[model samples]
Target: MEESTADLIRAQLRRLRSAAGLNQEEFGKLVHYSASMVSAVETGTRPYDRPLLARADEVLASGGLLVSLLRIAEREGQPSWFLPWLDAERLARQLRVFQPTLIPALLQTEGYARAVIRCDDLLSDEEVERRVAARLDRQAILAQPDPPQLIAVVDEAVLHRRDERFRALMVHQVEHLIACAERPNVSIHVIPLSVGLHIGLSGPFSLARGADGGWVAIMENQLTASPTDGEADLATLSARWETVRNEALSRQQSVELLKEVVKSWP
Candidate 1:
């Protein structure tokens, strides 16, 4: 939520409390928040988080209005350009990904996803939560009755990068990767650091195969994804996919590599 949205919620809280003939201290008692914390939220010094908002909604007799507002605010926080790609991902019969920078979105744990999102120091906490929710929501496709076949070719560097803040989640993510690889429909590969140069070094890309057997390539730059369905472009990306496939470690080898990382993390 933006500061403006926070202000709106605070205003509503204040009005509802006033109407109920309760002072800040009385309202705080009802909502189980400190008087100072209530004041901070109302005066825009603090944002209204979900749990607080839920309690406030119940105390103020708002009939879930605040909770509904939270949902609306979260949806509004999503980046505009990313929605289309999400639609494609949900519909794809098969997904082929070449990721070099970080774990693929489908395999990330909530903690790992938030740690990655927080790297953008500019984003507010509410914004960070929204992005995390969006990313986790995207992971649901993997659990569908006939989920997409996930083939991820990731570089070894992704496993080597470690910091105390994210190391635990990285361990969790690596274990999760190994688990996903065990599924018959999923295939994961690691491009060994020894393979100094590879086609994936250029950047990350994904190929989504549709039910009709048509393939589309999605590539991202700094800002947003550009999905190409043109025959020539798809053909070129297909060849790149084959080249990376040959350079990456086999599925069994990738599982072994992930197990190694799991053992190495402190």
Candidate 2:
């Protein structure tokens, strides 16, 4: 489990209880939680499992419905591993994504995602379904009534390197990008290879604004993710995101560039 996310989930639960003016025992009784359970969860001494937390949300009436947490949790599958980062991402009011080697995950078309997922020869069909379902489910965050502001910066090379089938998929993907770019909550920028290596070379990262006004940074390698919630680390990621954003082409420019790429598709 990511320590950062674990702490954030616990903090949010504690805040909910405190706001309701309930002590641990009282809150426990309301949600059928044991006092020890409440204490353990709050202290991050126990796993902050989603199902348990969802029941508590019902008792507390947080309206985020706790089920949202569960959904986000299920997406990761390995709760003990990615829960913290997922929790922080779920609670964020804004998300900034920077992808240097691939299309932004949230914006991937079904076809594109299918091709990429198929490349994972180790994944059984069932495993691929599970992963793809999770990825698509995460896109729901963008459609919530109070969805986060999403700003994405993608590397241009992802747009140019594709086979015929992938090219067609990318054409659809770029159209989808154009539509998303029209939303007030979404902004997409493309990092042209011409500009060459920027701060994002550090790695793919997302900076999410937590409900508590703190920022959380998520870094992902091939199969694992790490989160940094320390103010200092968040500041560093935030600065890098800003630099990447500045170096990327504007949304209009990106759309134009994408149009030109699609035209050259064979």
Best by TM-score: 2
Pairs of residues at least 3 apart in sequence or in different chains that clash in candidate 1: none
Predicted structure with the largest lDDT when compared to the true one: 1
In terms of TM-score, how similar is model 2 to the real structure? 0.73
Clash counts for all predictions: 0, 1
What lDDT does the true structure give each of the candidates?
A: 0.80, 0.76
How does model 2 fare in lDDT?
Answer: 0.76
Kindly list the per-residue Cα lDDT of model 2 for residues 173-230, writing each as its tens digit. 8778888888889988999889886778778999887554557777888888877666
Model 1, 1-266: lDDT tens digits are 34355457778888888888889899899888778767866765433456677888888898887777666665776443443345456667899999988899898888889988999999999889988997887787888788889999999999887778777778888999999999888999999999998778889999887664656677888777776666998898899999999999999989998899899886
> By TM-score, how accurate is candidate 1?
0.70
Candidate 1 stretches with Cα past 4 Å from truth are: 1-78
The runs of at least 3 residues in candidate 2 whose Cα sits more than 4 Å from the true structure, single-residue gaps closed, are 1-76
